[model samples]
Target: MTEAVSRRTPGTPCWVSLIVHGLSATQDFYGALFGWEFKPGPEQLGPYVRGRLQGEEIAGIGQLPPDRHLPIAWTTYLATDDADATAETIRSCGGTVAVGPLDAGPAGRLAIASDPNGAVFGIWQAARHAGTHLWGAPGTPVWNELITRETSSVAKFYQAVFGYEAQAVVSADFDYQTLHLDGRPVAALHGVGHALPRDRGPHWMTYFEVEDTDVAAARVVELGGHILQPPREGTSGRLATVSDPEGAAFTIVRSGER
Candidate 1:
């Protein structure tokens, strides 16, 4: 039972954004690796920016159009009340909208889809913005992965558009697969056949909630950003992979062990 859409679970992950080709160095490399606090948005929505932490808000940063070849990512948005019937159950489960059910006036009703093994996601409908109200603490947005490669038809196209419920869980050394929704849990699809890198595509990979991922991968290499996997330790904690400084990409965890 994964398709339980009543919206407002704006707690465990509320936000996470990125869609860049260069938004003037993505607000100074995620504002010096997450002290975040950008504001100016709306010039026909080009160089957007919102992310805030101790003062609230939480995520967003935009600017896309380097020919729209798109890939400089970080995307995860789930908090739906009815984004046009969730984009018609994400196009009847095969998924692929790529932008808008529209309206972002009161900061609600957005759409930008992709699943069906392509990954990308977004579907907020909060009206006055009820997301990323500071998730898992630290710098916010704890985790949400999809890293596909067709993994079982991307888990049956997100269990038929978000009523998720996979459950595999093996032990002794990891053998993952978890994506419950009503039963809780909330993300993870991972496969990448040979551990990703055949040119990488098959996305959805966000994770921010840093306290130390090796001092945030050394302040993401002292601000020009570019780590791309460094700190390790998993089971559900210390991780890394950075990019910003005009090249989006994300991942950073420090959340208390799962």
Candidate 2:
């Protein structure tokens, strides 16, 4: 198991969470695939649990509100010193803050927002609960990336909101840029042009590390999830795109510090 640490740097990809319709079934699917144990969390919102591996927090799963119909997807949260200030910056930068900079019962203050391109993400100001606790282990999130229609404008939007230093990849075929914080690459933006998924829209994708991409993909299917993309050789390692039973998509990769 990898060691646990608190990520407090503002603008870093600190946590990934999912709000699903069937909480129990979603827990079952991910538990089987990633060996995650659930622990009840702040009830201020609703039924929520933090996913742990060998007692280290990795991610969060929560129940969706019954009366409200929203997209089933993973949200990549960026760490911030003040969520309200970040929310204002998002609005000034042409992004939309849809949810609250409200309290999660003293655990943290959070706000859900969307980029100008409609890619949803979150801003977190940690108090008692520091974002994600473990890394470089199978079943823990390793990376967060944004997939959008274009990189130039969205890159500026993030740079203004988060103080990220954008470094564009000089390539004729690939329109990509890596966002850096304190000289360390924290997240990335990929311009897929017209190839962006219509159903999912432009969104930030959360990538979980696995021991073996093929085996993990198979396990996802066996546990009632669907493999949206078959295992392929990625620049980092073997990876595959898969979605939970409720159709919330995320990627699994066999690459991270072991």
Candidate 3:
């Protein structure tokens, strides 16, 4: 069991959000799958709510922008001390800051950006709300990783913007590297080359912790979601890639469950 946290180390993934068209239906899917309760929050955003588990905030779900056709996917937010500076640094690092370093009421400041490889993520300067409150438990985020065409350049971009120390994990056949901050493994990068999903492109994939990956995948299917990958043994545990009813992709892992 891991302790609940109100704050996280800067440069590490602090929050994840999903924007979809049907808020009520999406909420129902995740709530039934992960046992999440919803609460309206950061009202500054048009239609948004925070998903909580046993009173601790787990993630966020909001209505998609009515004007644009944004892909339905989870966006990982990295903790930062200064959103303005981080947004500038992202621009200088050859990344694009598509949204604001603006305030989300008193909750925090935020900016949406994408790496050179076009993997979108967020920079969060937390205030009263310090991102996700609990982790390492069932229904909470356990890992955030970048899946791109190549790791060399995008890794450098993240390192320059967030000061992540890149350590090559598998360089022979697979180009994988772990991103560390203050000597702690915070995130990772995987270069899958031509295998990158044409519809999805490069993106940050969020992995949530569960008690049983197989059961969770089954539950997702029951809730009108789809399993992109069947339960498989991963380095840390059993995991499966799944998408919600709205088509937001995320991974679920059951640690130490062989």
Candidate 4:
């Protein structure tokens, strides 16, 4: 068992943010679904807004470049010590850098990249901002998982870059692997062959912690969002699949336990 540590220091993970195509619609959609408030940012940031869950900074949303030809999606950002070094390590581990170790002023430096299997994530070097300040709470980010077709390649790539250990868990329903950091489970990897739908692409899905799955599901539809999967009980908690107005998919879990 390899013990892994976050490149970020203690009390990190202060916030998280996503870049989408539409900003107003995305902000309004998520704001209503999660009861979040948005604070506007500069124009260069492209309609950026800080997402607040129960008055705490949990995540953010912004608009992507028009010519990027990228789909509206959510990307997870892990706190790190140095974005440049992290990007270098990602390249050495068979990952591709999509963006730069660019400065975000008060937010910090960031770089966007994809794993060997094509799952996208970000690295953050917090100068003034950490990550999700409020996580594992109602209407906040709870967990993240990378679902990919090439499990072995993805596992090896992330382990090499982050020093994470992959632990396989077997069950009658599904066989999943959890990524451990410092002996603590922080993320999960699911093989696309058996666990996910055939049409699914390699991507990182973020889960928001909620208070009631049913209520959240209803609110999702009410806010013009779509509930891809209704509330269902799982081993971890009550889970639901949802998509924002612009079709960015994400999950929600109502749980008191981590």
User: How do all models score by TM-score?
Assistant: 0.31, 0.97, 0.96, 0.88
Model 4, residue 50: distance off in Å is 0.7
Q: Cα RMSD (Å) between model 4 and the true structure?
A: 4.2
Clashes of each: 5, 0, 0, 8
Clashing pairs in 1: 2-163, 2-164, 3-163, 14-132, 229-241
Model 2 agreement with the true structure over 129-164: per-residue lDDT tens digits: 888888878899989999998899899999999899
lDDT of 1 at 120: 77
In TM-score terms, which candidate is top? 2
Model 3 residue 81 CA deviation (Å) reads 0.5
Candidate 1 residue-wise lDDT, 85-181, digit = tens:
8788888878888787888776677788887656677877777666666667767776787776536667876776666778866654444688877
Clashes by residue pair, model 3: none
Per-residue C-alpha lDDT of model 3 across residues 61-172, encoded as one tens digit per residue = 9897778688999999999989999999999999999999889998999999988778899989988888887878798998999999989888888889888899997558
Backbone-clash count (model 4) = 8
Task: Report, for every candidate in turn, its global Cα lDDT versus the true structure.
Answer: 0.72, 0.91, 0.90, 0.75
Alpha-carbon runs more than 4 Å astray in model 4: 1-15, 42-44, 171-173, 194-200, 256-258
How many steric overlaps does candidate 2 have? 0
Q: Candidate 4: minimum summed lDDT over ten consecutive residues — where? A: 2-11
Cα displacement (angstroms), candidate 2, residue 44, comes to 0.6
